[model samples]
Target chain A: MTRLTRHDARRILDGRDRSGRLGALLDAAAASARPAELGGEDDVLTAFRAAPRHAVRPSRRFLARFVVVKAVIAVALLGGVALAASSSLTPGGEGSPGQPVAEGGRADPAPNTPTEPVETPTAPTPSPSDTSIKPFKGEDGEDPPEPGRPSGKRLKQLCRLFLDDPRGARAEKDYPGLEERAGSLERVRRFCERLLGEGGDDGDGKGEDPQDTNPSPKPSASHEDTSGPGGPHNGPQGHKGLSARSDGTYVG
Target chain B: MRPPPPETDTELSACVDAARSGDEDAFRALFRAVQPRLLRYLRVLVGADAEDVASETWLQIARDLRGFKGDFDGFRGWAATIGRHRALDHVRHQRRRPAAPVPDEDLTDLEAPSDTAAMAVDALSTDAALTLIASLPQDQAEAVLLRVVMGLDARSAGKVLGKRPGAVRTAAHRGLRRLAARLGPDADARPTDPMIPAGALTPRDAT
Candidate 1:
């Protein structure tokens, strides 16, 4: 029971008839990996042809889901249109009548009273002062100001707002129609002005210049080893005989 | 009628392009051409599970055949690399699952029975030497296979194994030494045969 010498290790490691072993191994591998029961050359060819086609075709599951989604949307749209059409055809159902209705099936008001007065004033035209609040224009028409300014107490409130609960921001309505809040819109507008900047100045600490284009590591007095430690030359430059090249390249 | 000589890489590339466009026959020819090499590589990578790995490798190649971008040689190497990886994975799996025990037969040391008669009458066969080689470890086996089967030099073998050329040369040297040891002290004294037959275990009858 002697330990194998380097020579023995080498001899064993370098032995020749590797191809036969490789062949044997290949046979063993082929036995297990290939789809053997699938049949012979014709079967293989068929499978090969079928496989690529199957891969290119959309998966049945995906196609099925796509059809179901499209059908559901189409049904919903058709149902909406049918309801709309039925409502339009039925009288006294929001659609305007051709003539004015009478209590006893007779025209009541005088025609001179004006069937449709030209200056009846249906709704007042909004004044410029009423529409004073304009949308905050963004830089390059992108990443618009997030609305509202945040100063001292409001800034502190904002800090608490985010720190207390970040999800609260989503609940705040930026538009007029739904879920009105008490003075929250103004607060948000002011907060956004401070956060996004009074004029889209980017009030966030990053400010106007986002990326730091210039970077400077601390200067060190240590000299570089040009000769590469073990190589010839005395100075840190390590240049043995030749000085700097004419093109300003360091010659070692 | 003799069909035109075996398709070259350029021809194969053109065939693969057609195959990608659903040209069934062209794809089949490409598969037949590369399957053998892929199988061989996988076998080396995974000893007994070559079939499973080779099948899986081919199926994968078939699935991704349309996406193949390289020339024939590149395609071959890429496929081999994939097969090698799959084979390695199978080997790892087998190691995890303890299977049947390997026979304690030391084929490495099996000495070819003395054949003084062959030297006297028939020529020495290369298979005798190769059989002696098969008894070596996987590394030596691969080195020999690459050299003899692929006709690669020691440097090329090193490139395949990602090792230094000197290391491959040393491995080859050691492999020959083991062969000599198996042949007995007088093995070197026996005339060495150079010619080899394809596929068969026996070398060409002594030159």
Candidate 2:
């Protein structure tokens, strides 16, 4: 017997079989419809009538799912953008102040001095300083004032008085303690000026006239001192000013 | 040995379109044309439960006919695909609740009903032929039934079976060769003999 090729099978399946025997066999095998098979025509027709005329089309279902999926994706993208924007903004705000504080804290040999400068700049009113003065005075009076290094309490007091009434404080009688802490009254005024600059506290605008006249040289000197290698004496005030300027630039 | 004339593609497509528009007679016409082939294919797949699965298949077809597209050939393939799915579902359902196994004798009797007195001989031969085809491997039996009984081409049969056209063709070829071998040489010896006459061999004349 010849082998049945795919082509012969295809021809026979398509009902164009040249060989009569295989075709006849297929015809006989395709049995006539029994009563049971045709009996369900009425039932199927009843189901057809019961089914909705137009419940839902497949394309319509697909389109609805597509829209819902797209909406979810769009909302997720917007949420991600909002979260990224807020996160990016917070780091910049924190890094501006934090970098200078970190640099100052890292470079300063005296960890205790850095906190004093941070507190002095934030105390814009005399009343807050007066409240803070009592604790310091009690703490410092126990340790007798050192000759070359004035106590922090005494320095803060002298700086406030000098800022309030510069002429009166400069007179040798009003703040004899400050003049005695230093060698002369001239040195006391210069010390107060350095303290105020380090504090960055020109907020009251009371005694800013003298400093404003020569402020350009001070900032340039401070900028040079800060930019140069390892000038820890002037670093705190320079760092504070530098951080405020950077914060302004970032916000704008 | 001749089968009845099958519906032409034009008439079948017309019936499908009209049935989609809720024409009852057209739907009945489509049911008459497709039900026998569907039942035959399902009998091979699910045995005695072919009628139940075919009913479920038609219900789904009736409900989803509005969503169907393509011509009459596509409609047949679509119906076959639905029938196959329902048959598989019935098999799975049976496996889940396997209370008692029906005997082979009862299954053969159920397939060839004795009540059809006029067509008893034809039904017996048809049942024997189907039983013989079903005894082959599952893929070969499906390939033969879909290709021959359902009158689907290899590609259409491939779509219904979820196989590639080449694989379907090869399977159908191997199945036909196996069936030919099983039928023996005497059945094939007179293929070109003039005893049957050439006019009777034509597909149109078979009707």
Candidate 3:
């Protein structure tokens, strides 16, 4: 039926619980958050011990998948070896029995040609964030021009491709606090991908507007509030503080 | 409370290392340090189901201890997260089976405090205090318990409640204000809260 302003309450309880009669209640409740003396610690410890060992044993699904992958590689290797042997045998049997091993290797190049196509199949794992584009893969698959040259759209495309390459992911794995950097880089990559009309494996990225282009929000988009307690304009910053704190909830 | 015994954070870190090596005493020290505050937070969150939820929480903590990657502060937040989840699940179960009676043995078995005169007074008032806390609105109760009781900074408490820190601060302030009101106008004059005086709450921020 009655109300107290937050300001009034803060001023009153500013120096709390000196004598200990009432302050004891909040303290006691806070302390109660700790483990009780019910000999429950032992039981808890026992239950914890019962959890699956924290050993880095790979999951069963990973193991099964690894086995399958290994099996496919083995079969491919065997097929290549068989093709190599038959090509060598035919070179000796048919055209020139006296021909050298290197030359004979290309005598009936059908098997060797087929093996090229087989090896190319390995490129199809379909990563969502793959950024490698073989623009110079005509025949020699030569590297593109060096980055020192400044130019038009080609340069920007190259930069985006380089940043988004899977090598960046491997490099990121080694750096301690690179996650934030990687996130921003990924955003840029996604932006570039959209610019080039490249469809991403990420499903939710397709948010309508095929031609309506939007810029990637920079990592520094968040405005950090330096104001400590409050001021006359304390109203707007009120909501942002709570949302910032909530970001830390899911600790690993 | 009592400035967290000065050596607490360092001692906790050391005990964690020793406990990971399977030292019983070290593990007990950790359990002693964390259990009280953890139980208090859970009590407010899930009421009588606090002990069961706490048991589940500790089990998860023990299992995950070896893989944990932060200081004592991080450990508290981590433990609190697990405890909050367990408490939520217990609350959900209670909702589905509202008529089911909570098993009473857990609360019946709590080891009483050794400091007779102070905690004896504390015991009675604290019980009354909990009753009063449970009567507060749910958000207010959680915000107050996390800030005033569990000693979490507003930001950390916000994470546990999945709220923003500003929201947590407002909620806590409102809850305390309401609690002051419920104490029948004399609560402020009744012993005010000092920063971690003698028993129970620890200022982990101190260490």
Best by lDDT: 2
lDDT of 2 by residue, A98-189 (tens): 22234343323233433332222111222322221111111111112234554566666666676554433433232535644543222344
RMSD for all candidates, in order, please: 27.7, 40.2, 19.2
Over 4 Å off in model 2, which ranges?
Answer: A18-20, A31-36, A54-252, B1-6, B108-116, B187-207
lDDT per residue as tens, model 3, A1-252: 236566543332332442233344465554442213444877766745553353321233345345445545544554455466467764434443333233433333423333433222112221213211110011111112223333345434443443344223222222211212222222333444454445333322233422113323233222111011211112222222222212111100
Span of 10 residues, lowest total lDDT, candidate 2 chain B: B198-207
Worst 10 residues of 3 chain B by lDDT: B198-207
Going through the candidates in the order shown, the clash numbers are: 30, 0, 25
Q: Which stretches of candidate 3 lie over 4 Å from their true place?
A: A1-24, A31-38, A48-252, B1-7, B17-24, B103-119, B186-207
User: Which of 2 and 3 is the better model by lDDT?
Assistant: 2
A129 in model 1: Cα distance from truth in Å? 74
Candidate 1 root-mean-square deviation in Å: 27.7
